[model samples]
Target: MTRHILIGLIALLPVQAAAGTIGKSEQVQACVLRQIDAAAPVADCVNEAQTECLDLVMKAPMASVACFRDARDTWNGYIGDRMAHISATAPTELAGVAGIEVKYDLLQNLMQCDRMIDLTLLREDPSEATEAQKARCEATATALAYVKLLLQSRNLN
Candidate 1:
């Protein structure tokens, strides 16, 4: 009887993990699209677009990290290439606009959190993370929450 119960529990693990990941992915995508629509100016638009792309990277299921990483690298590369072209061709008035730095350090930190989530998903072992990793992940999550709030505030104006 104990053996049968253990087998059933083990079988349920994959389903639970998949369900949690899918919910998170959907949430990330929804938040991203909303941000894109709220953004103003070309720079803001691109930054928001990149954020959306990163959200996809971070929210992808752990079972699919390789695919997610590939897609993200390609997407970020394309954005970089396009920005280079814009830099070469843009009018002087618009040139400064292109270089406007978005909050990238914060975004990268958030992506790291997403990567940690991917690891957790695959391991089914959230407790495996070191204390430092946990603190960094929590900080990233808090930053993202604040950024989302700031974006929403812009919509009000």
Candidate 2:
């Protein structure tokens, strides 16, 4: 009887977790949309979206893995669209800087998501993740720093 009850409880765990995740994802999505609507410029919108998205991903419960993946993909797509616009509309010299800055911001946000995912995954299964996860996280951080440097260089010139 005890074994049966244990199995039953275990079976319900994932569903309960998923429900909680969905609720959190909905909240994050609303926040992202609100920030996007309030932003005055393309850069500001992207930045706000990225920040909110990262916050959501980092804070979401472990059951929200799928939600995190979806959020990352959505944010990446948005950034791609904004990059195209920046390329065509921004001033010639500043266009590259703007694009890099935007990419950096997006990537930095992604790294945060990755870190959260890694930490969550580790909590669930510590021995299974590849070393590459850490490497990717570090590389993204470095690249983001370089992007900042490029923006600063452009400003100084």
Each model's lDDT comes to 0.38, 0.40
Stretches of model 2 off by over 4 angstroms after superposition: 1-63, 110-157
Candidate 2 structure, TM-score to reference: 0.37
Q: Write the per-residue lDDT of candidate 2 for residues 4-94, one digit (tens) a residue.
A: 4323323322222222212242343344445546773323333343343335433553323344434344433333433444445556555
Candidate 1: worst-modelled 10 consecutive residues by lDDT: 12-21
- Clash pairs, candidate 2, are none
Report the lDDT of model 2 for residue 47.
Answer: 36
Question: Model 2's lDDT to the true fold?
Answer: 0.40
Give each model a TM-score. 0.32, 0.37
* CA lDDT, candidate 2, residue 152: 40
Off by over 4 Å in 1: 1-63, 102-157
Error of 2 at 157 (Å): 25
Quote the lDDT for 4 in model 1: 40
